[model samples]
Target chain A: MSDNVVPMKRTGEATPSLSPILSLTATAMNSVNQVILDRMQSEIPLIPALAGHLISGGGKRMRPMLTLAGAQVVGYQGTRHHKLAAAVEFIHTATLLHDDVVDGSETRRGKSAANIVFGNPATVLVGDFLFSRAFELMVEDGSLKVLKILSSASAVIAQGEVDQLTAQRRIETSEERYLDIVGAKTAALFAAASRIAAVVAEREDAAERALDDYGRNLGIAFQLVDDAIDYDTGTADMGKDRGDDFREGKMTLPVILAYARGDEEERRFWQDAIAGFRIDDADFAHAVALIRRHDCISATRERARHFAQRACDALSIFPDGAARRAMVEAAQFAVSRGY
Target chain B: MSDNVVPMKRTGEATPSLSPILSLTATAMNSVNQVILDRMQSEIPLIPALAGHLISGGGKRMRPMLTLAGAQVVGYQGTRHHKLAAAVEFIHTATLLHDDVVDGSETRRGKSAANIVFGNPATVLVGDFLFSRAFELMVEDGSLKVLKILSSASAVIAQGEVDQLTAQRRIETSEERYLDIVGAKTAALFAAASRIAAVVAEREDAAERALDDYGRNLGIAFQLVDDAIDYDTGTADMGKDRGDDFREGKMTLPVILAYARGDEEERRFWQDAIAGFRIDDADFAHAVALIRRHDCISATRERARHFAQRACDALSIFPDGAARRAMVEAAQFAVSRGY
Candidate 1:
């Protein structure tokens, strides 16, 4: 997995060597991740019988790591960090369950999805269960601010999903519309999960705003990179098949940009392959080749890097700490994985 | 619709006279039902074009009416009642969207269901959108109590759905479990809506408890009548095809109770029909007839009446206002529909 990727050096960067910070962040994130898994197991009994197979099937756990790292950057040592981490994971899981059902996806992470195994009804209801359980856990935290933030994020995510459905296969979707969907459906939760840590830690207004901005930028960069990976990565390395978004007719940024730049013939190809119901391997190959020819992939990667840079800049207000250093490093890693 | 049903009299018995209270309640309910339909129309622009057709196809808007009647019973003059009514309606619509997907139901209200029309993905996401919209509206009321009640009810309803999935096709399911599922999934929201009035009015604790009990019992009775109607009514009146529950191997209360009292041969028939995966119209007819032979329908109807009576008893704690009287009559109407 690391063969094609060259790790960037930090010589000219604002941050110094991140080796120690990255190591510590990794340890803290793993601990919090374990706590999340444990809490999910305890709360959802059916998780072991049905969901456990998927939970252990191998996921990046990137969202939960971001949450834990966010709490760490704010110097949060309280046990509630565990709850926040679990909340983030639950939100992530809920989205995945609904996504599989929405996309009619059969396999995920190289294994049959919950919908495929337990059937769509169980998957949908279990997803609802996870969402409700997340709320219950948040309520137990007894923070009105946290509740408000999480609830609002939940709404935004749902609205974004609906927006995606409405905009699917629509070649006319603007970059602004695409960003809005990604921001709401993906980045919003990431941003909220991180920003919530400052609120929980009772940080000052300046500190809170900085972390919030950092989280928002990092989330955008993270999603952009994820979208790029869906196009760039291999099926085995990605733990699932590539071209899934294209197969589902989702109008991601690369497709939108490529379709916008395409000539009459290219546009016709897109219409036939995506909108006009002609989806075969040849269509997928043409779509991918067209995207590459338009340099949309590189353009998208550059955009992701811009957000990553902004994320690092947002953390400048933080005191010199290992967690802050790791935050910057993680943003870089998001972009690096795409190359 | 009202021809054979005996109207309730002042002496708590059936009478030939047309009940003015019932007429008034129906009038008020119809007014609120119109409000619900109008509000659903306002949200059409935010949803897919197909959603409008699916939603407006032919929903009965029964739950919204219950919310309106609940609020009116307390003489709630505030316009917030309409918002709450819409919220309840949104929740009901959301549940229906998910239910259609879960059951793979193609037709609802005599037209295509949202899932069938827009596909499962759109239906599920739109359901999420509706639920989020409901929460947003509830939040606007600026009542934390209402938010808490509604959110909790949503969680319970979600749990009940999961419980039903886990228990599906299990012929050994107990009567107690059946009530639990129905109470949580169906009655909880009704109970929450009615009890919310007392919370909003800042009424006495006893009054709140009474309204809550009234709503809960009313909901149970309402669902029992609905279950009975599934077996008794024709496709035209019911709006959707019937006998799917038995075909799908769902063990409703009547089936569970009938199975418990059946002879060995009769038990074998049910086993083959439900557990042995053999279901046809003949099997469905036989199951219904068996339930009838065991007087399960009448027994269930009596249970429903008991709940309705309990709901009426709860209302006795309130003053004898027209609204209260209407609520009492409405409860009677709920159970007496089949007779």
Candidate 2:
């Protein structure tokens, strides 16, 4: 329990960094970056202007990096993965743009949200452009199987989003329902990003299945940690306002768990806060206190750790190499973020 | 000119109808309809609920009919075109959903808009899901050429929408710019829908180009008539509020021509009405009177006639048959709609 609770250092002394996979995929990832730049260009000034504002605004490219690493681990040598990885990143960025519009979020990735800067209309339209651009990349890659996987993932993600929206401010949202939403909205894309590498590598079904498992578990773990971090008051590095889920009345894991474990008074408080949608700083503080008192934050983190372990175990089928080790570390890093 | 200006009977006597094409493609179109229903279903109840609210709510199925007619004209005997047609319809429906959000439109096809009924967030997310579903259908079709044409068209459509947004309320929007916007926003999908049929039939490049041209010209004609009808006020059609473009300050061809033809005082009226966004029924009546006085409605309809003629010319390459005649009539119907 103690080992799982200690935040793993991501980029410091006495820590195994993700440099192994990052370096291994450096050349290809650069090409992917260039493709992203090239494709985001359009003759319409507003199209490029609004798209560039979001695309170049410090996205971290975690999903594309996973794609490159997946390709590397599968011993794929072709350049097509670069385009697919770019497509993956474009889809993720498009989702972020839409999410901000949906959430009416003012800030993202430590900057004012694109919708705030360019207005909601431009943000929504440019997000559509980027999404269309992603499909164009997939078409250019000329792999129907890859297109099928990613497209299905996209549909699932949208369904998950609607599911989340329907569950908003509902204190009775079950753990099963929460996991279903997370799996559809987030894990599906992660799984597709890694599984695409196997499709590119022309690997056997077993390999594709293994990578899919790795990504699915890692995605669940990553989302669990994100949900938990919204309640943690540590680093303020969630790229959003702290306790946004609370303010938004989002039915995240922490809230669900806290409600489940709380006494009648606490239950009433949650019901009033969520259903009535009233949560100022003081209410948020009380909510945080309740979360901490029930140890739901750590409990949520423990769930993430459990999924992360499964993610690491799924990588065992691959040969021992820097890429494999880096993927395992990446899964751990997903849950280990404190900042 | 008289033949082109007179309204073609769509579901009445005294003129040819689209029933030729619709009946010819009934089997395939039914399959396409089924595909739309099947794909819209999801475990998440809200997604299907919202998507169905829009999709099942009386869309004319015109675009998918074009795809089917295109296939029929090309002598296609395979079933893949059904899926492709469904995909094409999904893309169109998805765009409508998003466009309503962008336009803040309150009604569509004479019903309360999906965004109003389901809320903007649900509308945007479900639009995204349908778009993804379209891509999945394209992938299932397993034709890279088809995928390329449709994906590129999707990107261009998004760009066209942004272009239209940027040009909104600007009286100085050039005819060339307006045409570009119309071509990108509407004709591109029509062109792709027909061109894909040629691809499915493995037809000659000449046939493909002919179908593409036919669809493009028809789309241009369709949009031109739509723009012209905004000022007509004779029919209770248009699926949206009368003078919607005027109230929204949309730079349609009628407004462009009216602005160009107006005198100094009238120009000031036009500029203030557009730029100031001050529109009431009296103002709308004045604007309509100005348009009628300037002959812009007939002028706009004349432009539509020219495109309809071009659309008919493009179909001459096809051997005359039910499909060919229906397509030619469809082009005429595009511009000849009275309501």
TM-score of every candidate relative to the true structure: 0.86, 0.95
**Best by TM-score, which number?**
2
Chain B of candidate 2 vs. true chain B, TM = 0.95
Q: Candidate 2 - CAPRI tier? A: high
The deviation in Å at residue A7 for candidate 1 is 16
Candidate 1 iRMSD in angstroms: 2.7
**Residue A127 accuracy (lDDT) in model 1:** 74
lDDT of 1 by residue, A1-339 (tens): 223232233566644233544575576666666755665552325544455666677776666666667777778777676676677777778778888888888898888888888888878877775676676666567666776777777778887887887888887878898888888888888777777888888888776677767777878887787777667643236565778888777788888888889999998887766684767777777888888889888888888888888878777766656677677777787777635
RMSD of each: 5.5, 3.6
Q: What tens-digit string does per-residue lDDT give for candidate 2 at B10-75?
A: 355445456777788788888999999998888888888888888888877888888899999999
Q: What does chain B score (TM) in every candidate?
A: 0.87, 0.95
- Candidate 2 recovers what fraction of true contacts? 0.82
Please identify model 2 stretches exceeding 4 Å from their true place.
Answer: A1-17, B1-13
